[model samples]
Target: MKIDSLTSVQGQQKLFDNGNARVTKVDGQGEQPQPQQIASTIYHKDDPVLPANYGTYDIKAVINENVEDPETMNARYNRVQELFGFGIAERSVDLELGYLSGVESLSQGLRDKDWGFSIQDGELQVIEGSDSLSDEERSQITDALKGAGVEYAAQSVANAVIEMIETERSPNGLSRSIGRFDVNQSNFADVVDLRSFMEDYQVGGKYGKGIVNPNDIQARYFGAGTGIMDQVAAKADETFLYKGR
Candidate 1:
């Protein structure tokens, strides 16, 4: 049967007039019929479609407007401290004490799996761990510190080793004498035995006298004082006793 000769031809034309029909055109080169482009549908007020709305907002601007400036923030903080009868104990860090700084670095170095140093009995030493530093590694670190304008670089490196050994926290959260020093991204040419270096010197364990290290004494007092203040503030006229550790 021919398509045009069908009885549904009139019904199909009526469907097309009502926008319910798809039209196609046959290609001239014996290709399949292709769909004709259709005009977009215009939605009316009665159409069942949800409306979409979009907008942009500046959150940073809102935050900045409400935030207080640095000076004002500091003033408010100080005022609060005064109201609580709290006085902050400040300690000046003397970078010139390169030995102390080195010990601090030692703490950091051991934490970072780097070279470790220590200071005991008025002497400073570096630990020779299982993975000892090579000559090339030592030279690289020395060069880096020198290039970085680190004064007393040698002393600092040695102290870092001491800090790791003396205050190196154990797995169980206690201090230990023997600990490994590991450095990453550094190569040393030769490894020295720390034990041999301290063979002539004796290791001091117990501090019979009062706190020797000024820094350590300051820290103990500062910590104890802070706790006292806290307790005094909370108890309000109640006495609290704290013995130095």
Candidate 2:
């Protein structure tokens, strides 16, 4: 939150005395007061895709596989997952995997003019990369984003590139650790999959009223029979080995 302007201490004091709306107030007799950053009121009603309180949605209904039309049922289920759950898995992985390194690479690319991107007045712009982009490459990027229904695809590309670059320059402490753990120590996909399954279990227990079992949903989704279930149970048991110890 950066303040855009400054005010006099006397003016701030007078404002306080008059009970006027307060911004940042400087101390001392002659000091100038810098205005505090105000929170932005602007928000996009449609951009987030899911509701803020998405947890309240009827999970069982959303994941229904028992509908008469298999194609319709699959489509409906897929749509729900895309809108609310697993569809973002790959993107989430991309955003997490080698995050720091990818960012560094992107920054280096930008600096070397190998990738085309720029920031001016806090806004990202996609310019020509160092080696000029082929028309085919440019068209491919634009077309793919357009196909995905992204508005302002060029700007989004620029922003994403900039974010990746900036992220490499200064990634969060926890993210750096997590990225390392995922890359060097553990199977990231297994972790994400297991977490998703466990989350479904909790969601079912909370709202299914004995009707929805997360394992049942997993079985259906993965075409897993009893043998697979047994193996899954074993995996789960192994994962929770220290739970009751």
Candidate 3:
């Protein structure tokens, strides 16, 4: 009826609809792709070498890392031991001094070895004799008895009294006095041994003219004795007489 439609629209619309409705096919063939299984890899290695024992370990390195130097550590240890030793030694000396001081405080009248209170004339005479002894005589008697080991106890008492007196006047005097006494005692022993050796060996030969041929060794011994006596006198004066004063 109308002019034949210039355009053929009948199949064109169908083709467009078919194309829009079509679904793409997926190929589920050959080994279906597995999710790439990746396991977490953890690598563990051996521990480093270490020292076996505790103290035996390289002390230097340990000290460097943990404490101080080797020398400082050793010195500190030794100093501790020394301090402990000194404390023990000082305590012993103090105890000894205390005992001696107690003995020294006793009266001379009560110091007699015999406990008898008899008033005999012979005992009185003996006491009077001792009272009259000069310093030199007292020293000689003390020395003789000391050599026999019979007067050490008495001398110790006397020394203790002297120490107390010195300590009362000067706080540290007793310690100093003890140190000096030890040194002098050693010196005295050495001198005596030296003299004895010289005498026995006859180090020096005879000298002088025919009639006046004198043994140089004997002369030397006399001189040495005189010198030693002088030194002894000086030391005694310094130690006993002037210490407290």
Per-candidate TM equals: 0.18, 0.20, 0.17
Report lDDT per candidate: 0.26, 0.25, 0.24
Please identify which of the two predictions, 2 or 3, would achieve the higher lDDT against the true structure.
Answer: 2
Per-residue C-alpha lDDT of model 3 across residues 129-173, encoded as one tens digit per residue: 223544554444334333433233323322332232232221232
Model 3 alpha-carbon drift over 4 Å, by segment: 1-66, 103-245
What is candidate 1's lDDT per residue for 84-190, written digit by digit as tens? Answer: 11111111011112323333323344324435332233233344455567676555443443343333333333343333222222222221112222211121112
lDDT tens digits, residue span 196-236, model 2: 22222232321223423322332222111111122233332
Give the C-alpha miss distance for residue 161 in model 2, angstroms: 19
Off by over 4 Å in 1: 1-111, 117-127, 149-245
Clashes of each: 22, 1, 0
Candidate 2 lDDT (Cα, 0 to 1): 0.25
| lDDT score, candidate 1, position 127 | 42
lDDT of 3: 0.24
lDDT (C-alpha) at residue 189 in model 3: 31
